[model samples]
Target: MWDSRTPGIPDELFERTEEVPITKEDVRALVISKLRLREGQSAIDVGCGSGSITVELCLQTRGEVHAIDFDQNAIELTKKNLKKFGVSAHVVQGKAQDVLPELPQVDAVVVGGTWGDAGKVIELAVGRLKKGGRIVIDTILIETMYHALAKVSELQLADIDVTQVTIAKARKVTTGTMMLARNPVLLISATKP
Candidate 1:
């Protein structure tokens, strides 16, 4: 079950009724804050589910936003969300590894999902990034974080950082009693040299 308090979804999103495995508001905020996006810079959002981060990227930056997802349902949801949010972003439906090579190089790339091909995705994304461009990836597992770290080392990114975010909320356990619930996330960001 998904937490109702989690923001970014709208009533029209439920019309399609396809489950989104994970939605991290912290990741969204971190990507926006860390990227320090500038006007007229190009950006791409890989595995862009429901276009939440994609739309946000377009809104926050003056550059063009390209959002891609392989799942048909996710693509539709992303399109719906983009329209609902009134953001202009290019939506593409395809695998990240395959579609990435076709698009023009960009200033920043955000990996929302990699389908377990983190190494290949990162490599392609880094290759496409302009000199000194940034790459931001969100991983929920230790294994994925290790993979990202390895890729950063392999690419020899200039500066690298891995951050873990934990959000705790108060949960009602019983009458007049409450407990703390926590959700943890891993964020890995690097810049191409």
Candidate 2:
């Protein structure tokens, strides 16, 4: 449904559920900016969820796309969205720790979930990231963010940056519009050295 070259696709267009999270539009834009993907640069979405980020990566890079998630329902939902958007990605139903090692080196990676194994997940992703490659990890938990930051630094990644994104959108209310803030995320971006 989204045929634009621009990155921010509205969140409502993607098939979503409470169990499977889709990166909100504003956050997706920031993540895409951090990735700095160019045409034909391959990427992997470590936690595909509703495939929102996966579809964006596919459109942005026009390169090989791989998506991994541990939940089967999430996998199915991802496939549906991929089909809906007429984009293709190799959707793998497995944990990042297990799936990331098998994939070929890529230009960028976006990790959305770690299943409480942020340290190992970041390590594996970095292992497969090509030299000069970019990686972005989104986590709401302070502990997870801290763990990811430490892991990326320990791996000696370059151009490391992290932003605590707090976004709010205006909504119609009685006689006026009100701003409602979405949950904050610690967005981490780095490049393999």
Candidate 3:
């Protein structure tokens, strides 16, 4: 189990699957920071792959976390990671569009995958978010950033922020250490008003 209250629980600690992707630890830190969640706040993790973000949210918020994913494997992986972390969350295996409506208002929403419907996901996420609630959309593809940006702008959310994170981890080479770059992630954050 993770001992610290900080975000970025090492990437290896979580149960993972090759088919499902988990947001990296360094990137998770930024996502959690943008959330600005406090204890007792509720959050919805859309496309909760590997449940890394869900675990962080549960640990940080110490509140309710609804983890929704379209893939059953992702849901199972998320549940396993949650169990490993000794954190509990509402793990649901369904499309975001279908599951989001059933949940009550939430303090934050984080979208890790859109499955090609970034706009639709953002719309639903913003709709269920409470006033002053924060939303973070994490996209590895540039196309998603464009769609999310346009949708968030159309909604006229406040405090819109876009960031591109590039992390390079050091690897031990024969003589020295070399930096291995991971894929870049673009984050779009906004607050509901």
TM-score of each: 0.85, 0.98, 0.99
Model 3 accuracy (lDDT, Cα): 0.94
The better candidate by TM-score, 2 or 3, is 3
Residues 53-77 of candidate 2 have per-residue lDDT tens digits of 9999999999999999999989999
For candidate 1, write residues 1-193 as lDDT tens digits: 1233233343334324457543555557777666657768889999887677776677667578898889888888878777766667888899999999988889899886888988899898888899989998886777778888898898899778888888665576658667564557788888888
Q: Which pairs, if any, clash in model 3?
A: none
lDDT of each structure?
0.77, 0.93, 0.94
Please report how far candidate 1 places residue 178 from its true position, in Å.
3.9
Error of 3 at 58 (Å): 0.1
Specify the highest-lDDT model's number: 3
- How many Å off is the CA of 163 in candidate 3? 0.4
Superposed by TM-score, candidate 3 places the C-alpha of residue 148 at a distance from the truth, in angstroms, of 0.3
lDDT of 1 at 104: 89
Model 1 poorest ten-residue lDDT run: 1-10
TM-score, cand. 2 vs. native = 0.98
Best by TM-score: 3
